[model samples]
Target: MYYHWIDTEKPAWAVTEIRERSRRAWNSLFAEERREKAEAEEKAEQERELKEYYAEQHRFFEEMGKKNREEARRMEEQERQRKEAREAERQRKKERARQAKATEEAGDGKGKYPRWTQ
Candidate 1:
């Protein structure tokens, strides 16, 4: 039987065209939505990777800071030890001068003042 346009039915040819066009439009819309979703997922993944990278960098700096502080403390201790050693040497020299002065006073008349006539 030949297909015909009827009062209650669409023509076969027109129905086919309408169905094909509707399917194409629906497929294109679906493709666009899929592309948008993929792009969004990629952006979220990039942001997560960036956050992890920054956290690692911050940890590295924190470790460096700890090492620097330890080095500075060691240097300060060395400087303090050197200063104490110098102070001890100065005190020893002062003690020797005092002993020499006492000895000279006890030697009294053994030698006259070089600039005077006794």
Candidate 2:
């Protein structure tokens, strides 16, 4: 069919060229649109993966922090127990020395420091 664009009937070869050009233009436009859509989808997928990676890393750090806290608490408890044991041992030693002093003084025929001296 002759195109209505001009006053004269276009030669057959000219009509074929126009049609091919129009088809190429339409295909290029659609291809560009498809490429844009693909790029946008790829960007969104990358963002999603990055978010998941960050969340996973945060969880790992949080778990590590919790473990560190538990370990510190265990160490603190152990130190407290050791301190208490040391105090108990010191008190026992003091009692033993007091008993030894009493026994020695009693055998010396002196009861203890005299009330008169006080």
For each candidate in turn, the TM-score is 0.70, 0.79
Please give the distance, in angstroms, between residue 1's alpha carbon in candidate 2 and its true position after superposition. 27
Q: Candidate 2, residues 15-103: lDDT per residue as tens digits?
A: 99999999999999999999999999999999999999999999999999999999999999999999999999999999998887777
Q: What do the candidate models score in CA lDDT, each in turn?
A: 0.89, 0.91
* lDDT for 63 (candidate 1): 100
Model 2 TM-score on a 0 to 1 scale: 0.79
User: Residue-wise lDDT of candidate 1 within 8-99, one digit each (tens)?
Assistant: 77889999999999999999999999999999999999999999999999999999999999999999999999999999999999998887
The alpha-carbon root-mean-square deviation between model 1 and the true structure, to one decimal in Å, is 6.0
Pairs of residues at least 3 apart in sequence or in different chains that clash in candidate 1? none
Tell me the lDDT of candidate 2. Answer: 0.91
